[model samples]
Target: MMIKLLAIGKTDSTHLQELISEYEQRLKHYIKFELDIIPDIKNVKNLSEVQQKEKEGEAILKRLQPTDVLVLLDEHGKQHTSIEFSNYLQKKMNAGIKRMVIVIGGPYGFSEEIYQKAQGKLSLSKMTFSHQMVRLFIVEQIYRAFTILKNEPYHHQ
Candidate 1:
């Protein structure tokens, strides 16, 4: 199955971008992965938080295919350990899914519409993280999960 991480805005830090790229490259060896960035909404300062999320949601929804499994990286979602997450991914892969889309919303998070469309939600942590930081974190974890699945030396128990 193809795995796609869809996020809003450009990753501003050069260091973070480099790290994300490293993991992304490693992930390509195991599965089809794509990091799709939806540009930040313009004039967000002029709009309310709800409005901003609404606009961002529109952009996000447009990129999704009906058959794609939408998973939102949400604060209120279930948190899993590295091994558990690996199992979760394996289950999806074994299910014969075409594509799995995981999304990271803008500063305001996702809109009600976006939430309604999501098939599942996952949280990396209980503490808040900058969207830029979260991008690298998720990619690295994805790489780790693949390594664990392959019995590679990249992850430790």
Candidate 2:
């Protein structure tokens, strides 16, 4: 199955971008993967946090195909160990999911509509992280999951 990571805005740090890109390249060896970025909303200074999320949510929803399974990276979502996450992905591939879209919402998080559309929510950690750093963390975890699946030496217990 194809796995895609959809995020809001660009990573301003070149160092972070380089690391994210490196993981993306590694992921290509295991499955179809893409890092799709939804442009940040304009004039956010005038909009409320909720309003910004609404606009960002609209853009995110627009990029999805009807058959894609949506998963959000939410703080309150389920947390899993590295091996468990690999199994989670294996199940999706076994079930013949055409595509899985994992979303990283804007600074304020997702809107109600976006949350409603999601099939599941996953949390990398209980502590909060910058949206930029989260991008790298998720990508690296995904790569590590694949390595674990293949019994490669990249991941440790």
Candidate 3:
């Protein structure tokens, strides 16, 4: 299965970008992985919170194919241990899932439409994180999950 991470806005911090790139390279050894950044909305300050999310949601939904399994990285979503996450990924591959699309929404979070379209939701932690930081966290966790699956020494229990 191909794993794709779609996040709103760019990672402006050079340090963070370097870290994300490191994991991106590591992920290639295990599976096809891509991180696509949806550029931030122009003149967002003028838009209402709901308006911004609606606009972002439209862009988010556009990136998805009907067959892709859409998972949102939501705070209120299910939390999984590292092993459980790896097993979840294994099951998707076992089921022949084509594209596993995980999205990290904008500041105001997802719209109703986006929520309706998602097949599942996952939470990295109960605490909130910057949208930019979440990109790095998700990528690293994905890499770690694959290493765990292969019994690699990268992940320590």
Give per-model CA RMSD: 0.6, 0.7, 0.7
Per-candidate local distance difference test: 0.95, 0.95, 0.95
> lDDT at 126 for candidate 2?
97
CA error at residue 95 for candidate 3, angstroms? 1.1
- Least lDDT summed over 10 consecutive residues: which range in candidate 2? 148-157
What lDDT tens digits, residue by residue, belong to model 2 across residues 41-141? 99999999999999999999899999999999999999999999999999999999999999999988899999999999999999999999999999999
C-alpha TM-score for every candidate: 0.98, 0.98, 0.98
Summing lDDT over every window of 10 consecutive residues in candidate 1, give the lowest-scoring window: 139-148
What residue runs in model 2 are displaced by over 4 Å at the alpha carbon? none
Candidate 1 local lDDT, 40-133, one digit each (tens): 8999889999999999999999999999999999999999999899999999999999999999999889999999999999999999999999
Clashes in candidate 1: how many?
0
Q: Give me candidate 1's TM-score against the actual structure.
A: 0.98
